[model samples]
Target: MPAGELFTVPPVRGGTKPEGSSRNKQKEYQLVRVKNTWCRVECRQEMPTTWEEDQVIVSQAKIGEQVTESGVSWVVKAPIYFCYKVIETQNLLNPSNKTLLYGHVSDPEEIDEYQKKTQKRFVVMDATVEQIYGSKVRKYFEAHNVVYKILALETTEETKSMDIVLHILEEVHKFSLDRRTEPIIAIGGGVCLDAVGLAASLYRRRTPYIRVPTTLLSYVDASVGAKNGVNFCNCKNKLGSYTPPIATFLDRSFIQTIPRRHISNGLGEILKMALMKHKGLFQILEKHGKYLLDSKFQSTNVLDCNDDAALKTTRLAIQTMLEELAPNLWEDDLDRLVDYGHVISPELEMNLLPALMHGEAVNIDMAFMTYVSHEIGLITLEERNRIVQCMQNLELPVFHRDCSFQLIKKALAERFKHSGGKLRLSLSTGLGTAEIFNNVSEETMMCAFAAWQEDLGEHST
Candidate 1:
């Protein structure tokens, strides 16, 4: 029999046909005449079979079997490609889907240009004090004729309330939507980005937004991915959403006016990325350690001191880390990648009454985590010492003594609850490999804390 010929008898819809001498499964076989030749063939069960006497039977292999010369054999696994074609049989079918824009911007001037190109409503959330960048941002928007709203966030610890930030975002979003805008835009550091990004997620039930990260921390770590949110009940970043921005713009010009402390803070985040994931970054930092340390202050002379080389190295390192970890950002497998040093740092920041900067706390937390890793035999003592030495070379504190042991224990216990009873922290196994654990004993934590306290005491006294 040949293919595509009419048959005298119509194929049964749900009835069985015989296969040689055995009873065939119902709807498993079809009999047809091809070019006036009659033959029985297996139905393509993977596809919907239509009944027609004029239609010819196509040879399709049976389930769990492959077609062969002698007989059907068990099927071996092979990749299959599926192409779908939607049939517009219904009158109400719609084909147009919503457009989502994702990316980042780094300059204040480029915000208007991006808005014009992407047709997204723009908003700039500034984490710095209003007296510094607020007027400048407003003037930039005005000169470019870009419609935007500037939310000048307060920098005090009391103003860092997650609820307050959320309220501000909600009000801004409502204002934007009262005029029928499509998307939201955020421009600032990690705190501003997280707060605004959360607002964008909640407003209109997940409106798209773009990020223009001005600070180095956001540029290297926070602003690149979709994780956005704010601290809850004094716990750092406790309430939030994993909402990826539509786009990100990396502009180095923003770093020009950044304060020295801000620069060092951002460096702390970069160091965390290097220590936890990329050994090449560690090498780069080691090579240019002095240059980075000297480039802390904002001066034309300081900027010319081979600082561009260090910035380029850090940028490349962060780009590589993002490319390697992009797929896992929204998934559940965040065990090692969560090694941003925020696990313990967040607790300290809350308990120490908020004078400690986020990255400073992270700096101390990374040191403690490294110490714990060494004690647990995950990493050698030398490696742990090297980690502390690197941080010290950068002029970052490896330990802090602002809180007492009782205060530390209380903070960790609270953190344990806030993290959903799982105290799994990202601990280093070596320079690049990090492990997450929920089973770190309280005794181990206290011992490590005590050691760190003693070390600090020796240095201070």
Candidate 2:
């Protein structure tokens, strides 16, 4: 019988129709057809049968079995897609799904409109935000009559353990938050984002969350990705999940109070994106990077303003990041351009913390990779110099003592396993273009490091 044809069962040798056959020791068979109120099935093997004159039988293979004659079988599956938006706003408290608001979020009235819109209660998780923003968050929530609680976290590398996560989950259970609507609002740098995001994901299987990245590193890279992670067992981000937040808000106002070096720290991730994909953004950085590094935009304090060159440059960098990440948010595809410096930077960053920032470690990784690309003839000497110079010009580090060849070779071995036994290393083929490499040799890496050291004298790691 053709597929999709309906059928019924016939009576047994005892002249009794099969009743509740589902519970009996029955063979799997595809149904064929029915006549009147009775059912019939074409048997593939001899068995007890009682047939009525009105019943009809048809031939078909058993269910869940494939015929060998034609030697063909197929099943179709639909692909899953995930998508979200990233926007810039002057003052997030003014009521927006995600906003980049300027000035301190001190005024309670600014967030009044948002309280009215959301019916669900919220829990604010802070790492360093309160120290930076003070009682503004508490006062705003209180004035708006928003049901909320505050949880303070250290958000340091040492504190990124399960204990911190469980502590936050305690609050989640106590608040009885509606997983579908109310979200945990994470405010701080990448550490806070990762810890809070992990807590939110574990509750009720998955809880919606909001991200307000307070540091520049979180703004350009960490918060934008769907990845949330915490260090564990002396490993960087060993425990984590790929859960995207409902939205991320970028506000330069928060970036203003931080030290100037932090801006350079964020530049490492920005430079990674520009190098791998957007040469135009790279050029923008080459020209206006110093202006941004100086916090000129925030110093001017232009709220509800546009047409700033620095702001445009930041937006371009963000747009470039989103363009690369939106298509592969969950990283189902392992071959990603964004994985350029990230291949080794995680281990490099965690091991050298206090001495090195996340972005700075990435810059050091990219610097060596740039030389590796050069040694392989993938990029010219001039191109290699330009890349290094661009990083140095932004006050980003090009080398660290811990980024030794021995350490790198060990990390590469582990990364090779993690990348399915292939290198999957991102290399520069040209300005704004990147290619993957699977056959980089240790000797070539040594030569790359030696060349980097020779070019950068006292800066050698």
Candidate 3:
């Protein structure tokens, strides 16, 4: 059936009833176009519903819907509303800062009421993070007189599985959380945040959750979005959901404890947004990336929140990410520029799990795709060189020995299969600009691969 508008059924009609409805109260609907468009369901307290289709003039609703002469089917088309903050605050360990408690209150109006209640939270923290800040976190919570359970897990790519999610759920079930107001807090890297999000989404069918990223990678990449999952069947984030958190609290000071390589790993993601849509960001990383890395994103005062390359880099990354994520939160539109480095990275990252960091794998994918873009005449040699040099300057790996042509072909094949039969690969047409190209030929790919290997794979073979 062709897609059209979905109209509400008038009150219990005393008209001719459709066959097979069984009873007067029972409504029937022939399901069509629902997969392609959002269809409104007529819901009443006790009345039945019937559905069919008709081509009519459009409505002000952005998502169109339709119905016709079929059994009544009721569906609540109410949109789920939840806003999360990606805040930048200092001394997350200090009870005086109240950074840990901010996730509990979504709005300022709730602050006074929240302070009056006995607060409690279930926190899922990365083992590494817990090792460094566990005592401090406990002290902060104790000082606030907040009842909290902090569960530490080794949430690494190697351990990103359903088992980990189940383990978290087991703890959450024991905690007897109040699903509505009390949130499951995630404190760690992307893996920790992803696992905790999945667990929170599963528990009680969508309990509220918060993300407090302690690594630069998670701070800039994972904490800004709603996508969460664990690896399954050897695929990265194979089992996942678009369940966003109630808030995502970011603190750059957390990066101080992480290794320098991990800092570089996060920059790989920052560089991604830069290459895709922000030229000034790319230039900043190109010039002052070393400063940001050495200072652990605290080149200026962490509390200042202004006047530094590190500050600009984090904000730019978050803004660019949100600009892409907010409208397409559910990924209703599969063609996304934010997927620039993700096409091959998932397979490549999983194929070499624990060896290559998520951002490293992504940078490698981006690096090769850069050559593909160059071969397709989307960018100049100078532009391609600048991107590669930028990656190298940020201490990111541009190529991998394990990332072979066969692997590339296989990854692309999987991507093509999953992406609605089209590659829909996002490639940089120029610095800070990119486009989704579904028509890049295998010939172009092979030529690009050969050039990419020659330029960066010198130590591979």
Per-model lDDT: 0.61, 0.72, 0.84
- Tens digits of lDDT, candidate 1, 284-323: 6666665765664223432343456555554655676576
Model 2: lDDT of residue 5: 31
For 310-333, candidate 2 gives per-residue lDDT tens digits of 676667667788888888887777
Among these predictions, the greatest lDDT belongs to: 3
TM-score of 3: 0.85
User: Which 10-residue window in model 1 sums to the lowest lDDT?
Assistant: 84-93
Best by TM-score: 3
Per-model TM-score, in order, reads 0.67, 0.77, 0.85
Supply candidate 2's per-residue lDDT for 173. 86
Against the true structure, what is every candidate's RMSD?
Answer: 13.6, 11.0, 7.8
Instruction: List where candidate 3 sits over 4 angstroms from the true fold.
Output: 1-76, 107-109, 303-306, 459-461
- Estimate candidate 3's alpha-carbon lDDT, on a 0 to 1 scale: 0.84
